[model samples]
Target: MDRFESLAERRIREAMERGDFDDLPLAGQPLDFSDVDDPQWWIKRWMEREQIDTAALAPMVIQLRREADGFPDALRRFDREDDVRAYLEDYNHRVKQDRVESRFSRESRIIAPVVDVEVTVVRWRELG
Candidate 1:
């Protein structure tokens, strides 16, 4: 450690002195942010920039929320009301489990609430 300069900072300073950053694209433009303290935050931003599917990286509740948004479509896979009801049961069971899991963590709970499968099934009928 030399004074307050970090290794990465020192390298960047040297590169600037050598004019290595002169010809870089968008070099003169201000960056929204270059440093993020949270690794998860950085990874999420990189995933977004790369157009990556980061559903696995998201919290269980967030994943559930996305699934819930498409729940009507999922029920469409079943031709019978009984099958639809069974699938809804399973989905709601998992949502309850996730809510319990959220209580065990001290970090921010991003878990969304469960959707009303009954109402969604009604909407599906209107669309049909």
Candidate 2:
């Protein structure tokens, strides 16, 4: 897993938290992407459901490409389930840390639009 996969996992967790799939249409359907594992299908589905902005999600495809490219070669060599599981645990932790650091940096910006708006309002009222 890499940035996009981590982000996608976060998005999925958020969606789950919001009960977005309580009565999911595909709940009982046996859907498998192994035969047709195109990432476009995921994007198309999200677009059709209006879950995310298509334009914003366009960059995620690039992230997915990076993720696919950076997938651990050790996992490919693993023949046992336990080995795969251990590799996934470490990979997941690394991805989680990357996602957290990325989010922290984004949040740390002092000039964020929302923060600027609040500050402007407070200063305006103070000057009045």
TM-scores of all predicted structures = 0.52, 0.27
The residue pairs found clashing in candidate 1 are: none
lDDT of 2 by residue, 12-121 (tens): 88898999879977788887666357757866776777866554553333443354344444245555555555655554455555555556564432221111223333
Displacement of the residue 121 alpha carbon in candidate 1, Å:
1.9
Alpha-carbon RMSD, each predicted model: 7.4, 25.3
For residues 15-54, could you state the per-residue lDDT of candidate 1 as single tens digits?
A: 9899988888887888766556666777778888999986
Clash pairs, model 2 backbone: none
Best by lDDT: 1
Q: What's each prediction's clash count?
A: 0, 0
